[model samples]
Structures are given as C-alpha cells and as structure tokens.
Target: TQLLEQSPQFLSIQEGENLTVYCNSSSVFSSLQWYRQEPGEGPVLLVTVVTGGEVKKLKRLTFQFGDARKDSSLHITAAQPGDTGLYLCAGRPGNQGGKLIFGQGTELSVKP
Candidate 1:
C-alpha cells in the first residue's frame, strides 16, 4: 500500500495569514482529494486534483497537483478563524483497492 505523508503536523496563526500544507507519496494516485473536518464533525470534501499540474481554487483556498501526480499542495490565503480544523489529504491510488489512503492529518488553528 502507498503511504501519504503530510507536513507541518500542526499550524497556528493569526487570522489573515497565508499557509500552505503539503501531501506527498511515492505512488501516484488516480484521484487525490482534500477534506476539512471541524471540531466534532466528519470531514467534508474540499477539492479533488486529478490531472497532473492541475490547479483548482475554491474561494481563498488553492489546490495544486504535481506534474507526477504523486504530490499535492493546498494553499490558503487570508485564512479566517473559522478555518480552524483538521485538514486531511486522501486519494484512491491508481492500483489500490476501493479504500482510500489518508494522511495523518494537519491541525490548523487560526486565531482572531
């Protein structure tokens, strides 16, 4: 099974700051997805990156997939206090089963 490694285990910053979280793997994924989970709720899908070098933006958050499709990054601009939560990166690998492999997670705390 391929492993997804995410960086910056935890992040804390003032509101309006910019941040970037990275997810990397040795295996390429067929589809890579990013999700955000609030304190007591299940994660909600944020964005999905499929094509290599594809870039997608949702509001102030931007998602980018590496040319090799083995790496991805999420950049949030002017992060707000409401953005505090756990961010996860997961994907159904090209050769893996139906199950998705997820990163350990990155906890973000944005203080007002």
Candidate 2:
C-alpha cells in the first residue's frame, strides 16, 4: 500500500518565524503535490513537483521533492497569521484513475 507520512503534526509560532514540514514515504511517486487548507474550506494546491530533486518556490514558501521520489519538504519563511492553516502532501500512486494518497497533514498556527 502507498502511504505518506508527515512530521510535526502541529505547529504554533509567532508571526515572522520560520518553519519546515516534512513528508516521507517508502514508495516512489510520479508526482507530489502540496496543499494548504483553511478552516471550513477545501485544500488549495500549493505546488506540484514532478522531478526528483526538484524545488519550487512561491513567495515565502519553498517546496522540495526528494531525489528518490519518496520524500518531500515544505519550508515557510517569515510566517504570518494569514499563513495559519493545515498543510498536506499528496501523491498519486501511479495507478489508473489517478487516486491520491494523502499525508496526515500539519496544522500550523501563526499567532500575532
């Protein structure tokens, strides 16, 4: 079975601080996606890294995929209250119909 595991399941930090969340797996994925979800809403896609050792950045956030395609990381720089949300990593299992396996997710709270 394909599984994604996330570290630092909960995080609370003052505004302007930095944090990094990790996702790991034993299986290789063709692609990996990161999502951020606010309360009462669906998760929004943050980034998708398809290549091994690939890195993508969006403003204060950076996402990296492992060289083995079995892990990924998300780093936030100078986090703000607006950044508080749930972070999730998901990957397709290289199967038909494109089913996705999701990580446990990390809940982040950036306090002012």
Candidate 3:
C-alpha cells in the first residue's frame, strides 16, 4: 500500500504571511500533482511535477518535487484571504494501474 503524508494538517495565518507545507512518502512515484479546492467545489489542479528535482510556479504558489520522486513541497508567498482552501497532493505510483494515491490534505485559512 502506498501512502502520501501531508504535513501541518491545518493552518491559520494572517494575510501577507508566507507558508510552506509538504507531502512525503517512502515509495517513489511516477508523477505528482497538486490541487486546491474551495468549499462546495471540486478540486482544481494546480500543477504537476513528473521529473525528479522539477520545480514549477504559478502566481504566488511554488511547487518542488524531490530528487528521489518520493516527496514534494508547496510554498505560498504573501497569502491572501482568497488563498484559503484545502490543498492536496496526489501521486501516481510507478506502473500501478493508473490509480492515483492521495495525501491526507492540508486545510489553510488566511485571515485579513
């Protein structure tokens, strides 16, 4: 069984604060993806990292994949109230029938 563990299960921060959370696993994955979901809506894909040591950025969010492909990190800079949402990490195991393994998820709240 493959499991992805996300850190800081819950976060509450003031606007303009920066934060970084992580997803880790013992198993190496073929690919990893990040998603952000607001209440009453489906999760929206943020970014996908397929190569080891790959890094991608979208607006104020930055994502990095571990060199070993077994971990990932997300960093948000100068967060705003609108950034409040549930962040999730999903991984596709190497040759595992195409099923994605999900992390426990991190809930973030940014207050003005």
Query: Which candidate's lDDT is highest?
Result: 3
Judge candidate 1 at residue 18 and give its lDDT: 100
Instruction: Evaluate all candidate structures by whole-model CA lDDT and list the values in order.
Output: 0.94, 0.95, 0.97
- Estimate the TM-score for candidate 2: 0.97
Per-residue lDDT of candidate 3, residues 2-89 (tens digit): 9999988999999999999899999999999999999999999999999999999999999999999999999999999999999999
Sorted on lDDT, best first, the list reads: 3, 2, 1
Per-model TM against the reference? 0.97, 0.97, 0.98
TM-score of 3: 0.98
lDDT of 1 by residue, 1-112 (tens): 6999998899999999999999999998898999999988999999988999999999999999999999999999999999999999997887657778999899999999
Candidate 2, residues 1-112, lDDT tens digits: the string is: 8899998999999999999999999999999999999999999999999999999999999999999999999999999999999999998777745888899999999999
Please give the ranking of all candidate structures by TM-score, highest first, separated by commas.
3, 2, 1
- Model 1 regions lying over 4 Å from their true place: none
Clashes of each: 0, 0, 0
RMSD of each: 0.8, 0.8, 0.6
